[model samples]
Target: MSSWEIHAIKYADRNARVRGDSFVFDDNHDAPHPMDYFMWLLRRGEEVILVDTGYDDAEAAARARPIRLDPVVALAPLGVRPDQITKVIVTHLHYDHAGGLRLFPNATLHMQAAEMAYATGPCMCHDTLRMPFTADHVCEAVTRLFSGQVVFHDGDGQVAEGVTVHRIGGHSRGLQAVRVRTESGWMVLASDAAHFYENLFARKPFPIVVDVQDMLDGFDRLLGLASRPELIIPGHDPLVCKLFAPGVADHIRRLDPGPTGKVPR
Candidate 1:
């Protein structure tokens, strides 16, 4: 298997949030709990794979969530253009993660079959259930589907040599996590599987959940997919920037650890 280099590109954030907003049950529910939005980049040799394009300006305006930088502009410093991305793995069709589908015009989208069905299905009729999704984003995905630019994975599917996606339907009907073979070992990008370390460590599910039992099961699934607890990257914790790749000041942080016995220092 080819080892890959993973980078988390921070795009937007929600600062005025509390513990209660993040966790279903927490003692310090009144305490502050900020979220940092990110879109991961996985690269090896000449292969470039993107995971979950962050929301765009329109989404930002509608949701009242301001973006620090445009995701396309965020990629320029890294030398990756939106059109250059060949494969984009959308963990789920949540507004924050899948709103930028129109930006990547040439890339083939990879998503779980259930997610597509759920996003377009009757479940969206409920206001509470569909709050996290945007209609135009779903429409864009449908357009891509008709254009033959979408690949629907039933469950577990491989995107590249060492990159694979696993279906864990808790947060969404088809929410999946990306597991990549890295220098350290297997690293699982737990996109909304655990919004924060405490979400998994404390065994508490996020408030915005579709199925309570499945959300709890997904936490276990994230732990099982990763090589270790440390290798599992949470979806939206700001601590991720500090915990991984210390001394780096930029928004894009390196996630893969060094070899088994080798630390970054």
Candidate 2:
């Protein structure tokens, strides 16, 4: 029975008028102004696995333009320092997800080999695909790789005892998700495979995805890996906190924790 804690570190917010074709929607809908970015911290005993590193305060604020919040400030209450993180599991190379990588100097960064290649490769020249990334952020990752601080996983691989990384190419070439074996059941963190529950439940892919078919397939794979659907947590959905049971802290959500621990169906 392994115990784990998950925290959502919000960095910024943007008002996005989601159109019908945007993300499994037929009409314009008001969403919670997309939360800038968040990093999920999973703690099991002495192992501190960080999933995604939210943008750096200064750079994110500058790029976001009129930034609403700082991710580091949000993490202060959690008592998590950049240097304290043991491992960083990057879901992708998007600026929002990898901007803060430099902050964790001592942590071993993990990411998909394909993602790193694409991020640093010529495909980044495409307007649609390149708009979301920052050259500086990607360069930092490249530097880390050169320094041997970044560990690239070719496909599916295990990072720790109960933490596994599974590549799901859609949002990005090497986008991956993390799966953890918890006391109650297995929890699959669907990073960007399914940004919201509707995406998964309705079998729809987000408009920002690169390979729509791959995204859909990834969702299916995520579900198959989980012991139950309730054990899956979608990325960028505020309803995540509401769906899963509360953890040690108010912001932390526990995907598996016995009868009272399961996420609401």
Candidate achieving the largest lDDT: 1
Worst 10 residues of 2 by lDDT: 28-37
Candidate 2: lDDT of 151?
Answer: 85
Each candidate structure's TM-score, on Cα atoms with residue i matched to residue i, is 0.95, 0.88
On a 0 to 1 TM-score scale, where does candidate 2 land against the true structure?
0.88
Cα lDDT tens digits, model 2, 30-57, are 4433533457888776777889877766
Candidate 2: segments with Cα more than 4 A from true spot: 19-36, 65-69, 245-252, 256-265
Q: What is the C-alpha lDDT of each candidate?
A: 0.88, 0.75
Q: Ten residues in a row with the worst lDDT in model 1? A: 256-265
Per-residue alpha-carbon lDDT of model 1 for 86-158, expressed as tens digits? 8999999999999888999998999999999999999999999999999999999999999999999999999
Instruction: Tell me the TM-score of model 1.
Output: 0.95
- The regions of model 1 sitting more than 4 angstroms off are 246-249, 258-265
